[model samples]
Target: MSHDENNAVLFGSGDEAPSNHSHNPHFNELVDARRRQILAGGAALGVLGFLGVGLPGESQAGERHLPPFGRRNRLPFTAVAVGRADGISVPAGYRATPFIPWGTPITGGYPAFLEDASNSAQDQAEQIGMHHDGMHFFPIDAQYGAGLNSRHGLLVLNHEYIDAPLLHPNGPTVVDGKRVSAEQVRKEINAHGVSVVEIRRDVRGEWQVQPSARNRRITAATPMQMSGPARGHALLRTRYSPEGTASRGTQNNCASGFTPWGTYVTCEENWAGYFASRDSDLPRELKRYGLRSSSRFGWDTLSGDEFERFDATRKGADARADYRNEPNHFGWIVEIDPFDPDSVPVKRSALGRFAHEGLVFAKPRAGKPVVCYSGDDAQNEYIYKYVSRGKYRPGRSDGRLLDDGVLYAARFNADGSGDWLALDLQDAAFQQACAAAGVSFADQGEVLINTRLAADIAGATKMDRPEWGAVHPDSNEVYFTLTNNSARTTADAANPRVKNAYGHIIRWREERRDNSGVRFAWDLFLLAGPESDSRGPNGQALGADNMLASPDGLWFDEDGRLWIQTDMSGSQLASGPFGNNQMLVADPHTGDMKRFLVGPLGAEITGITATPDFRTLFINVQHPGEGSTANNLLSTWPDGPGKRPRSATVIITREDRKRLL
Candidate 1:
């Protein structure tokens, strides 16, 4: 089946009152007229209210009644706020039930997690990983057999980072500013990567963790094979993988995607900043990829082969014999066949490089090519897509179908139309550009490994920290979050603002076509800011209710409900009047946005997913009061009082079984 069969369009022209035009002149005029009409109608309503005959809730004589777009309902259920010891607050109607917390046994064979527990790398894999982010649920069919619904399916989640202090029995001690133990380093390494746990609902409708045939954990030490255009490039070669065909582990798996064929696509984000590198010791090419001279976490100063090897800066005599391949292993989309417990994950090089935030696939058409969109997850990086050259075969659920594709980086133009620039090594321009950049590649393989260089040569627009993205169900329009960029980066035509602290959501529709088309029209949907900031020609504010800074996680539900979650630094959280970070729901058509839930103090509201029934929603509350040290705990959320803040996934459902949207 094609994507259109399962996806529904959420917004149409009727939903948008277009006055603020994007680069598209035609759309600008069309939207402007609608905005004027909306304003005029609003004014008429105000006048009628003054006369007292036609009140706010009442309609004029013979006029039809409009639905309540912004008014609050006496919702049958109330939202219960969940917090830790420091008192993390949530919305009033919802209660949070911890589904998976740090160190929970994932595989069922392990001993229960103890707060100060120290497990070997192998044992840790059987246990839940650290910092759970994006997660999703797959329901099992009864046809698969009894206990199937209760023990089948997978819960794939990302392990963003490790909490060093809590992971060890004692705090990670830096003796002379360098860690002294190899065991400490080993624990940290095991903490990063993705976890897949089997879960099921019992007769009572309560979900339970199960140790099943499909329960597994993939960590930073798991072996992964490279596929597609850049498979065996020289840049991927290291002592670990002499042929450049394989790499060890995946880190920073953030917001993710699942294939129509039922596989999981986990993204590698913020992977660059983890490696320790010094200016003098690193190669010029490596530095360009954001591995500047200094290490952000100071992990390299620690002892042990694992901790020291995490630093990409060279210390050995030969590049091929040392840690050179470490950088190459990361920054790619790692695909996992979740149903096949024994299958190895494959990193498709055809997708290109950079800090990937998430990947979303379009519904594949029978005769048309398959299209997938992704973000670079960094300030001033570019957006990209991979279009398969071969047509998608419907109902073909095999894994190998995703192996081949033509990668293209987007160039969104000011005129409202955009082009997808191909990054094919066979192209003459690409060959010439590669030669000029002092990079040698025999085929598309090398180009995929050095995708940033290729996009630079192609002149793709640099966006402000592009993060998570989702394609609208109905319109086939693509939307991506440009999470906040600090004052340091330069702003160009594509990114026209300076010091864009409060990020924005930009979206655009294809011109008379779907994802397979080479060209499309575009527009900026909403500029996120605080209410006190500024308003567009339409009454939409750049602030609080409407203004959300650092829009990270976004997903469109089966019912076409757009859910947005935010992630703000601690400094921004305390001073802003918006209270704390929150999740907002918006109707794309009417531009009706409302705050649904707020996170705890010093915590970021990340990763969100909804069940097909739209009855249960799962959200991750990550690192509450993150900046607090061992001696000082700012927010005791999820675990009030003596407990340290634990990153966890909260499951929410209406007690009455009503539709959440």
Candidate 2:
């Protein structure tokens, strides 16, 4: 999420006042305690010999090798220089083509994009939404070629949030500080969900949207189902779903993941800002997520039940009679089957959500319990993992497996070791810890509902705003990006820097390399910052070729290369050592890193994926011209001069049409 003035309120993770005030042990204290114990011969090994600088057994020699592109583990392309440009920059032999901008028609009467931003709310439902984020490619040829044929597939991506001024012709209509135009508010709501569009490569080797039945848009008004342990709970009961078995829509989706069963899971991030409550005594669920008197967008200021649902206040006699429970219906990982156009999205509540940044499943093995990780992208939040109760079967698995699982919050201990504290109500340790903290759960449903509070009681480590997570394709080691937390005044083993302006990446390996294990060994992969503050895997300061900050989006390609993307704030780009938000790929094994691309001014380079054959790469440039309003624009990207700036996805490939490393 961008930190421009306009986005500061929308992406409230960093700007908003933190709700967590837990008195958990600081990470630096834990590291000091572990070091003392090791030196006193009380411990067997010294995992934090030098504050867990790098992974154990890392090769110091050949760590800085810059061989030309030949081996799969080496970075192939020349590093792109850092600068603040008005467009994208790639290597010499690579071609970057802008594919789908904010408003391109794919379904529903095939409405064309209006240059004047006069498209109606109904038109937005039929067109692409704003601010494209996390995405994946589901090939249509999966049944035949192991889904490697990505030339023609469904390009499913998330629309994080809407730029209100750009969504309307002359900006939004307001009366006495409240939004008056119902259509404008409705259009913004429609642009806050997911887009599943059918895209195929043309004979000219250009990707284009195809008009197919599978090209569907699931927006804020789409009907969905509620599943998992918390489904039909009292906290989820609302007027729209009296039985509490369903929900309205998904919003503020940032990063996403796909299941082995061929389903897509979109994560809800910074969604609490969309809801408002005037009541002083708010429920813990709403209060913990930071719902306040006025919403960032005044959707509830309009006059209808549909718009009034955004006001999550207690007005009616009971929970089912009002929209007080509407906020609870959100914050969960929504599972959608793109292949089945008519399938209703299910909110898998067993995953235990709290401002979910993204969900990444570990490498799956048949007859093993399916495991996945999610970060609660907020200051001083905890990381969570879910392990299925039943073992996964390759061809027979589905979202039902997510309905029954053990959700655990991570507790990164001293000595570079960690434990997965189970949130289960029946677990003896969990029960005793809750009892000690004067916290008790009625059942598993309540435990999952108050996930953040439960994590605090479980003594989970306070992290520096955990965000997107990825699992190594071969080693199954999980890596998470702890984006910058400027509010931190104390250091800990997991978060070493106080007042951490630039973020860092943390990686861990489960016991015996088992994703379902309760213990793990962890280390700091990269301390992201300028050349002076940042440290690479070789325990050295980063060079000009790989300087970065606020590492947000992350992924491990099939070849085990770690692709890192940055989401630095607008102010950071103006005064920091790094010029623009960029993307870099690194060999986790050797610590060699290279800058691959740099985005335009005020744009965040996020949401990256590639064809299975490794020939093409797809990435999203969000909020180009970060602080742009209707009158004062900062950028006109993808489309040249005289055109309004629109966020879009860029498609890149090798010049010789060979595989892209």
Candidate 3:
């Protein structure tokens, strides 16, 4: 059957909600026009003839009316809610099953996950890490072909953070502000890393994790290579790797991306806070990068040299001997070839860093530079893009193709025009700025090591907590989730919202460069909030669709369906103003968004990916029913019936045997 016919049969056309007259007549008109356009497009696609779906009639004479939030269901598919009592929650009609949970064995004879399971640091490497976030499934075909039935392949997932308390038999404790137990610290270290698991579907169409030779885990102690402009820089010199040629491991692997050639790009964010340092003990360079100044979480107070190095203070003596190089090793995008278990992950310095979120690659076209977009993921950071020096060679499987590139920081102007400010340290403007700032750099290595400072000197536009990004399937437009910023940043023209507790999704379309255009047009696609409290077209209050705060994870399926996930705090969930953190699907062309699924209590729904056939969707439910103490558990979710909640990855598939797109 044709794709259009399938969509119509899956998602009926008459699922639109009833309209009600309320506020902002102009917004009402826009809503009506959008509905009309969707109906017309659906008919043009021949979706109306399939399944006997009827289209809404056109009328411009009625009174202004607004639809309730999440009332419209233009998309074809049903949400299926699933969880292990304390696991993630999905929509109805869907079943959620676990792929791999914490402490699950990978290889090397590690045993299955058991609460309070005792294991050494090396054994922990063989087990699954904590807090599974963004993930991608690369199907293995008979000959690596692109067919839906090709279900055997590798699943690459990022373990964002470790549950330090439960990871060890005893919690990570400190005596007199010093970590007393080395074993506890070691367990915490081993519990933070990435897991690559091999999965396959059986003859009955059930997905299961199968142990394979390719299955491996890259941990904190693993030796990694440094590449690009920042290789062998003075700042990277550490006693562990004195030559500055290598670093220990990748931490804070949050959201992630996949290369067209089949590699995993896991991002390291919030690594600075892991270290501890005092103002008087830090170097001038360390203080400049927001480290040593003040740490949000004081991990340095723990005892031993291992925990002390976590604090990037200049304690030992010389720069090489001291822990000065600690901060330099982090905050870069780490790339790993999932297929090769022994491959050393490369921290690509070409992608300028700052709280690096995941990196998304655009479809490579001939005569155009390979382009990738990334977000800084801080309260007032910036969105960045890297354009490769050479055109992307499709179907190439080598890992070296991503090593060389030109990084650019985005500057969104008020006139709907945006410019990609070049981040090359060799540029005349950059050199002059560096000299003026008294920041002397020997080469691009220094620039990348201190990328946040370089972007600052270049006067890049600071954004509001930029998160995961996705590329439009048909139009090539790029969309990113700008999660809320609570910092009291003044209202500027580009970001003209005050105390933006509720965030928005900012998107732009390139003018010419495929996805590498230096010039582009941009706009605020949607402002998330409850329908009764949002400002409409004329700046008046009106009901909006799919209102929620803090947009975090974003993904676009092969069918151009945009999935938006939320990461709301406990306070927001407790209040009746909104439902549990959920995922919403929208049609970008018509601005039609609907809430697809609501997660379990105290859980933030994140890290979503779809199967090749669009029949299965995978999402991560992190920290379910969090903030529940030993006495007052707000929720008894996946661990229902007297059990604690465990963060997990849920595979969602419809039970009716219909396609989910």
Candidate 4:
């Protein structure tokens, strides 16, 4: 989710600004070596197909290797035209039913949704959270080879953030300069985390909320434990958990990942804006993260420990005496076991925190180290990968494997090759770089605590706001969305457009097909924008059927079809030919792309997943009337005329009940 139009202005653009003092070369200056290599490969290589040229006398063997990735069954549905309709739009034969809107109740006596937004804090805790972002559907009968079961499962999703005006009946209440209603504040807090709801398809083919103990809500006020290398670090110490073993909750969870062992990973993005500090000289940890004297929300202005914790001022003599270290508790990837409602969510800090847009694990192999990828989601930030020290075992549901790992930052070079700089004290290169930068780490824990600083010392490539990542199911290649960076003034091969507003997607093949390898080959998969400005992987402008901007949510289904969703900002959506934020499908092999669905007015199309059988598809429509104020409403989505707009997930399926693709 892009927060630039929201409260992001409160925090200056220093974090989002370009890095003028970095030691690394301009990230986009790719050399001609890759072009030469592609030309030498003739028509056999996938690179040639991506380049959209065919060589004369192409061998039969070339045809076998032509697809950039493994072949997936071509998308069977007709393309949906771009539109600004105030409701869901899908292909002709598909039915998109709005399910589980913002206030839907699934647990705790099942409180019915009240249209006037009078739900209490406790009621909000038991219902679905607002602004759904990333999600996954866990099948109920996976043990019996029914992983593809379309009938029953748990739907787990992250509620990125809430719009205060749309959340309350008449917006938030203010007395003088402080928030006067603690209940409203509590409700807002309750709506800012992850939700695990049990859903099942009935005989009539409609998915319904199932009443079960597994249905749970992990809110911002929920109790959680801290784990990994930085678990007991002094930086994590606070009044809430003096030993640094626990944290309160997760916030700004933008995207997610699911473990092979049936667990969910929710990433904390833009979480720094929630904290405030009065200290004139803030620590680098807080300052680099954009923490100001005033937070995005005035939760600190209210009384009580829960609300006061938002203020990270150094009022007390020690960290334990105040909530100064509270902000550190967030910004880590939180692991949750949705099937076990009694389990406590753990903040896995070993992944190395920044604005973690999402975490996408590579294909896990038994007896091999677990590897995963994440993007920082801030201008000039870098992409990261974590290689677990412990070998991954099939069906091991523990997240502790993520605790002991070497977190690496990517450095994309000009020759289409990249190195993963280890952010470890044990690495000689890291030590030398740290010495040159006049920075030293007290211990490995400190290095993990200050991950962004460690990456800087190691000289990682500055990216154009890397976001959601997806690993190709067959090729094992990794792709990440470089969602626009308006502050960027210089263009390079990796990021070719100055003030890149449309954004682009980049993918790479790891060295020797090993996810833990330190080196890789990369290229721009697609540049997202209007047909006039954007270019597809084939070096041609995007056609009418597939024009897009701000590529955000991304996924590859079991069949290897790449599902791309957009998150165009208000300014871009209004000015560009792209009618609204949309979801598109693309063939990784042939580069054939088409628009799948277009969202309602002022909404972002994100959080997509499907039944194992590919018979049902689920996507989220977030913040329909995004810029709506207390007195003005721009759209009423999922509900008609005069109704309050609510963020909800839409379940799409073929009208004939056939497989989606």
Q: Pick the candidate with the highest lDDT.
A: 2
Clashes of each: 33, 5, 20, 3
Compute the lDDT for candidate 1.
Answer: 0.65
Off by over 4 Å in 1: 1-93, 117-123, 141-152, 277-281, 293-308, 313-318, 397-399, 428-440, 488-498, 534-539, 542-547
Using TM-score as the measure, name the better of candidate 1 and candidate 3: 3
Model 4 clash tally, residue pairs: 3
Report RMSD (Å) for each prediction in the order shown. 11.0, 4.7, 12.1, 4.6
* Tens-digit per-residue lDDT, 1-661, candidate 2: 2223434444233244588888876444566555443333212221222233233233221122223344455786789999988999999999998888888887898788988899998899889999999999888876345787778998899998877877887777665546677888889988889999889999988898999999999998899998888988888899999888989999999999999788889999888888889999998888888889988877877889889999998999998888998998888999999988899999999999688999999988899899999999888888999999999998788899999999999988776778899999878899999999998787888888899989999999888889999997876778899988898787543444578889988887776444888877676777787775667755556888898999999998887788999999867888768888999998876667889999988899899888888888999999898767767788889787867889999999998889896
Question: Which rank order by TM-score, best down to worst?
Answer: 2, 4, 3, 1
Report how far residue 211 has shifted in candidate 3, in Å: 1.5
lDDT tens per residue, model 1, 311-399: 67666766576675578778899898776678899998888777888988876667677788998876567789888777777665444
The list of candidate 3 runs beyond 4 A from truth reads: 1-74, 77-89, 117-123, 142-149, 279-285, 293-308, 435-438, 489-497, 535-545, 628-634
Off by more than 4 A, model 2: 1-16, 33-73, 143-145, 491-496
**Candidate 2 overall Cα lDDT vs. reference?**
0.83
lDDT of each: 0.65, 0.83, 0.66, 0.82
lDDT of 2 at 509: 72
After superposition, the stretches of candidate 4 with alpha carbons farther than 4 Å from their true spots are 1-26, 29-73, 143-146
When 3 and 4 are scored with lDDT, the better candidate is 4
Candidate 4 lDDT, 1-661, residue by residue in tens: 1333333333222233332245554455443335444324222123343322222221211232223444544876788888888988899999999999898997897888788888999999999999999999999876446476778998999999988877888777755446778999999999989999899998898999999999998999999998888888899889888898988989899989998777899999888878889999988778777777877677898889989899999988899989988988878999998878999999998998788899999998888888999999887788999999998888663688998989999997665667899999998999999999999899988888788889888999887788999998887788899888887676654455678888988887776444888877676778787787666655567888888999998899886778999998768777658888999997777767889999999999999889988889999999898877556888888887888889999999999999898
